[model samples]
Target: MKIDIVSVFPEYFDVLNLSLFGKAQAKGLIEVHAHNLRDWTHDVHHSVDDTPVGGGAGMVMKPAVWAECLDELLGLEPADATPDAAVDTATDTAAGKPVLIFPNPSAPLFTQRDATELSHADHLLFGCGRYEGYDARIPAYYRAQGVNVREYSIGDYVLNGGEVATSVMLEAITRLIPGFMGNPESIVEESYTGEGALLEHRQYTKPAQWRGLNVPDVLLSGDHGKVDRFRRDEALTRTNDIRPDLIEQLGCKALDKADRKTLMALGWEVSGEHPRRRGK
Candidate 1:
């Protein structure tokens, strides 16, 4: 996959040159490039931001600068472009399209599910916004021209810019690419990959006993069936104690006879909203 990022501080992307991302790029599993947003400016200072047009506290990234950068890099002609529109023919494509992503605090929360989908895209273009954000017209204009564009947030809190968020997202997506991981089964067994979409169960290494504590007896029993059940139970217990919200999201769909029994033992209703179990 081809990944392109446009940011005011391209050097911020050096993080991509480390660890898995670096190895992936070197092995030709993915391509990553970071461009300076200021390169599209014509001014002597090459500024990319300007005071808000109306009344606003922070400056907004200029659409003109972004327009040039995007049009030149992705070869997108604005919906309103004239016959003489400045279009880059070398990098442009009719069938080759890119998904445009803008990271914002108000956007839909990014999840492993999103990472799974993005890992398959042919091209991904990220616009790392700063200050207040890019001009609202940037995404609107791209969508009007038939481009696939989306805004996503890593979480509810705020960040200085989308640069760090981009790195976080890139890592999640790139690591999912086929053959990227040494053990593919690790992906399937991860916390949110399947039925147990909750926190992982406690893990134990060699020297089963430490101090006065010991590994769960079931784990050392050599019975795969019992071991799996014990792990699932532990996973459910941890989720209930820590993030019941995830269980709530899963709803009744994630429950079966065994799971319902576990919850009942913990003083939770099998299918009711109230904590106290309703007499079934």
Candidate 2:
């Protein structure tokens, strides 16, 4: 996979050269290029932001600068056009188009499912916004050119800029790419993955008893069947207590009789495939 990141602080991504990412690059599994957004500026100051057209507290990034950078990177001609309603944002990456992403605090939260989908892309271009944010028209104009543009927020809170959010998303998406991880299976049963999408159960290593806290007896047992059952139940219990929203999202087909019984014991009402908190 090829990844292009546009940020004012291109040095922030130098760390990508260390650890597993560095290893991936060494093996030729992926390629990364971080470009300074200011490189696209033509002025002496190389300014990339300006005061909002309407009164605003912070400066908004300039669209012209962003457009020039993106147009060159995405291999497109500059055109004045409205976003096409027929443009499919979900087009398959195999179609040989690069996926364009922007990090925005107000956008929908990025998810593991999104990472899985983007991992298959042949090329990805990420624009990291600073100050208030890039002009909204930047993404709109790219979409009009039939580019697969996406905007996402890593979490509910705000950040000073998109650099950190882009890093977080890049890590998530790149790690899922084939040959990126030493053990690919390590990602399969993780939280927010797979059909059930439940939080992962707690894990313990050797020396089962640590600091007077003993590992679960089931895990220590040699019986794999019992161990699997124990982990599944723990996952269900943890997800219910910590994030009941995940329980509510669970489909009936995903839960078996034993799972239903466990949820019922925890004051959850099972209606069809969905589970609800009691008295809610």
Candidate 3:
């Protein structure tokens, strides 16, 4: 995979050379480049932002600067004469296409599922907006040109800039790429993964007893069947207790009789293929 990041603080991504991601790059599994967004500016100050047209509190990033940078990196002709048409249907087939991403605080939260989906793309271009955020027209114009443009927020909160969010998303997406991890199976049963998207079951290492707290006896037993059952139950219990929303998203088909009994005991009501929090 090829990743291009456009940020004012391109140095923030230098850490990518220090860990597992660095190893992946060394082995030629992924290629990454971070470019300064100001490099696309031609003025003496190389300014990339301006006061909002409607008089906003903070400066908004300039669309022209982003367009020039993106056009060059995405290998597309300038859209100067392009009409403001609806996004083309070709964007529906994103395989092998360059996906353009922007990190926005107000956008939908980025998810593990999105990471898994984007991991298949051959090239990824991330535009990290600063100040108030980029001109909305940037993404709209690119989409009109048939580009796969996406904007996401990492969480519910705001950030100083998109640099951190970009890093978080970059790691999430790249780690899912083939051969990125030393243990491929490590990601399989993680939280927010799998059909149920349940929070992962707790894990314990050797020295079963730690600081006077003992590991669950079931984990120590040689019976793999009992161990699996114990972990599944714990996972369901934890998810329901800590994140009932995940439980609500679970399909009835994903649960068997044993799972149903467990959830019912926890005050969940399963109706058809959807489970609800009882009264709701």
- Preferred candidate (TM-score higher): 1 or 3: 3
- Candidate order by TM-score, decreasing, is 2, 3, 1
Q: Which segments of model 3 are wrong by more than 4 Å? A: 81-94
User: How close to the true structure is residue 72 of candidate 2, measured as C-alpha lDDT?
Assistant: 97
lDDT by residue for model 1 (174-219), tens: 8899977777787776676654487788889878899989988889
Tell me the whole-model lDDT of each prediction, alpha carbons only.
0.81, 0.89, 0.89
TM-score of each: 0.86, 0.96, 0.95
For candidate 1, the clash count comes to 0
Q: What's the distance in Å from true for residue 31, model 1?
A: 0.6
Which 10 successive residues of model 1 have the least lDDT summed? 85-94
Q: Report the lDDT tens digits of candidate 2 across residue range 1-280.
A: 9999999999999999999999999999889999999999999999999999979799999999999999999888888876554267676565777999999998988999898888898999999999989899988888888888899999989898898998899899999988989999999889999776999999999898889999989888899999988988899999988988888888877788889898999888887658888898
Question: Which TM-score value belongs to model 3?
Answer: 0.95
Which of the predicted structures, 1 or 2, would earn the higher lDDT when compared with the native?
2
- Which residue pairs collide in model 3, if any? 252-273
Q: For residues 94-135, what per-residue lDDT tens digits would candidate 3 score against the true structure?
A: 567788899999998999988888888888899999899999
Candidate 2: residue 78 Cα off by (Å) = 0.9
